[model samples]
Target: MNIKKNEKPQEEQLRKIYTPLWQNIFRGATENQDVDILNILKKVPIFSQLTKKELIKVSYIIYERKYATGEFLFKEGNPGSAVFIIKNGTVSIEKSNKLNIKDVYATLISGDFTGEISLIEDSERNANARCTTNTTVIIIFRHDLFDLIAREPLLGNKILKDLAAMVTKRLKEANEELVKYKLLAEVKNDH
Candidate 1:
């Protein structure tokens, strides 16, 4: 491949890598336009960066499972394998405290998601996810996601970038909360 004198190879490579995913929509992509799964995925932040064409590809690797109320999606010590996106229903993100009391840390409703860590690493789940109501969730297993990446690196890059951003934002929020609580405790001690 001959590089034009005016263009740097690195710049050309980046342009290919960063080609807009939304171009398909402007070009009248009619396929998968009406699919319910595509509509559901469009709202998810992880997949929000994808074009309809890329989303149609994602729809291929997802599994929809319905869980009964009180059923656990995954336990705290279990090896994480999938990211769960709630289609419709309530999910409780629970953690057991040092006193062995079960605490519901977060309640996620329709269109919300969790378990993103599983996609980026072979880590154990830090908390348990239980359905507070009969729930339908879209599960994207790591194996399937990796397979997608192997087939379409661009789509995979977009997803991984989104995952990293989500994790970073959450970690920052957690750190800020910890600082606030520590300050509160120190003030109480001073009094």
Candidate 2:
């Protein structure tokens, strides 16, 4: 169809009117305030000491992932390579006995974190992490963390120190539990 020099085609007019409105709606949906990565990072112990600028840098290297209820985030004996900070929902840290019966070791909720062992070493997971509800997590892969450290040594040092402290604390707690269990076993054996 031929159009007058002063009049736009019907399709062209519709495109001009709808494009900006669609763009705004799309942007709003994708950039919701609840997905603020820096704020989420601040709640995590390893990232608590970071400055806003540093957190922003760290945020660029990390990403968000979601899991459905009953989904396993990682299984015991799987190669672990990333740390996950719970942004929303609950996860169960479970261990399987010799008979393959799973026992829940801990229930982690939003603002809690897990998979920290993967940050320090390349090893198999010691327990399984399964989503108890629809869950969202901030994941930081080992390679990304190393890259961040290489680029920002000061921030990296702080994170490494914090991670070490967390690991030490967890080790102490685990040791205490082991001693308690051993004592219980000894008492039962004597009976």
Candidate 3:
């Protein structure tokens, strides 16, 4: 007896994964009116230079979410799926110890984006984000973004460059803060 190859199972599995994601994205978008909020992102330093058309494309892939104060947006080591733009309130980025989150490393306020580092590199989240107040955020998923890049290389390159520059600037500021803290510690020790 001859055995035949089965492609149906693989196709069904893919459809199962993609279908719900597409539906969720569409539902989130329709409910949240993300386009209106995304308009404000153009004023953000990293994305301010993006043209109107570019912004529109980016807007479509973004969805708005609201979190109650003290709610965790993500935890360190969790898989990064999307980058977030803070629309309202603040999010505290904290480092996780073995069993608890501690050391408030950064507070991202309105007009700031977090998790972009993971989008480009497909890495685990480096820190935890918790809502410091009732917060609103706009999220753009990495897979949706990658698809856009495949179709539009120029716009994608511009976004990637801007993201890299933003990360570099943040890193520099963080290094300076570390140096300042180290100096303060040494001064205190001498007393």
Candidate 4:
């Protein structure tokens, strides 16, 4: 890069203006400390209903983590303790078949979320979540959720309601798929 005698470097210009005053307040907050969490959370359906203030409160309890390609986010039958929202890259949900082969149930992309059951209950995970590509995920642990609920009951209620709605919607879709598959099988049998 060539610069004239009177010209300031781009980095120097950015350093002077891009640093916000609030960044100083949150210094040393967390390993992946960044300001984009609220924007990310707003895109997730389960958190879409929350107001800006509620989302800001929730952001404090969330943490961001990265996974390399081929890393397992969580294995099936493992005890669940946190919910994950995909921030970047892809994740594959897989289950073991009778032949012991892993069959991919779904490929989730950015803006998709999983592990919600862990947030609401103590059941084991039902599927294996593996990173298909280098991925970034935002995690909300059960303990943090509990703390949020204790501090803000109304926000907690809204979150729970939204979560329930998402689960119900998924169940309905699964039921519809089952019906279609059953109808196809019956047709095949008739022929």
Candidate 5:
């Protein structure tokens, strides 16, 4: 690396620009920190099968942050970029109705993840996520995962497979719930 008379070190520049994001997320992933993160990821269903080594690779790209109650992790229509895993506290997923009132569709807790679609697609978030209490979340941006995949195809492929399976399962469950709701509406109208 060449140093210019007027320029600051690259590391310094990065630290200044991304300080908050890195402060908690990238503190070197020390032995104790690695075990702590590995334990959290292990509890998450999508990453359940990843080996210790694989999880360590994944951990390098993770960013963890804490939010106060009522803060939004993301808003509906925001460009989706990362998947978030709730490490503690609660987050509620909501959407606006025709009347513009936000209706919460789901409340997520520890070990649950959201925004998985962002990992594979460039799309807007369909719902909003707001913390219902002080919360800690682990975020993995799509670009980071893709870059890792480019360098480690086997690991990337495994993550992609797991993400796909998780999404498919959720879609199926949502479809079932929709059917049940439709049936209930029909029954109510018949009376």
Candidate 6:
């Protein structure tokens, strides 16, 4: 992750290209601002309990990334280093396959979190994320999240519990969907 001195300038320039817009969003998250980003985040159930100050703090560690339509954010089975919070536009969650056309797993919108499985275990990603449209996302690096949690155990614990609940809920929903599909298939075959 350490870049040479010569690479630092380029890295900083790249960071600057996207940081301003995200900074504006974070600043708005701190105070009562009428920005669109604030309203979007306000609708997110997971962050509903977060205070403005805490939201701002969470924002500080976030980096903005923009992706063009059809660009793969990360491939399934690649090592994940950061999780993404969709700030704008849509992302497709796809499954890996040997066939030319991969399976479309799910679609993610603004406020949706991805790459969370990396936090629980340092393993290859389970799915691929591709930009379905021109997309802008807020990135939270795993290291930064870990460090923040380490610095504030109480806040960190709360975040972890929230994440756990989210994962659990999603799993249950998927299971229900699977059962419904199976039952429907059985009914059709019974005819």
Please rank every candidate by TM-score, starting with the best.
1, 4, 2, 5, 6, 3
Global lDDT of each candidate:
0.76, 0.75, 0.70, 0.75, 0.73, 0.67
lDDT of 5 by residue, 30-112 (tens): 22322366787876656667889988998999999999999999998999999887777778887887878775666777666
Residues 133-157, candidate 2, lDDT per residue (tens digit)?
9999888899999999989999999
Clashing pairs in 3: none
TM-score-better candidate, 3 vs 6: 6
Residues 20-109, candidate 6: write the lDDT tens digits.
422322232222223355454554444555667666766777788889999988888799888776777778787755755665656676
lDDT, candidate 4, 57-157, per-residue tens? 99899988999999988999999999888777778877886879775666666666778788878999998999999999999999998899888989988
Q: Against the true structure, what is each candidate's TM-score?
A: 0.76, 0.74, 0.67, 0.75, 0.73, 0.68
Q: What's the number of clashes in each of the models?
A: 0, 0, 0, 0, 0, 0
Query: At residue 143, what lDDT does model 3 achieve?
Result: 92
Task: Report the poorest 10 consecutive residues by lDDT, candidate 3.
Answer: 22-31
* Winner of 2 and 3 under TM-score: 2
Model 2: colliding residue pairs: none
Q: Compared with the true structure, what per-residue lDDT tens digits does model 3 show for residues 1-191?
A: 12236635433443444344322221211222233565657745456667898888878888888999999888888999888877777788777656563656567666666787668787999878999999898888889988987888888888778777866766675566567657756876899
Model 2 ranges off by over 4 Å: 1-35, 182-191
Candidate 4 error regions (>4 Å): 1-35
lDDT of 5: 0.73
lDDT value for candidate 6? 0.67
What TM-score does candidate 2 reach? 0.74
Candidate 2 or 1, higher TM-score: 1
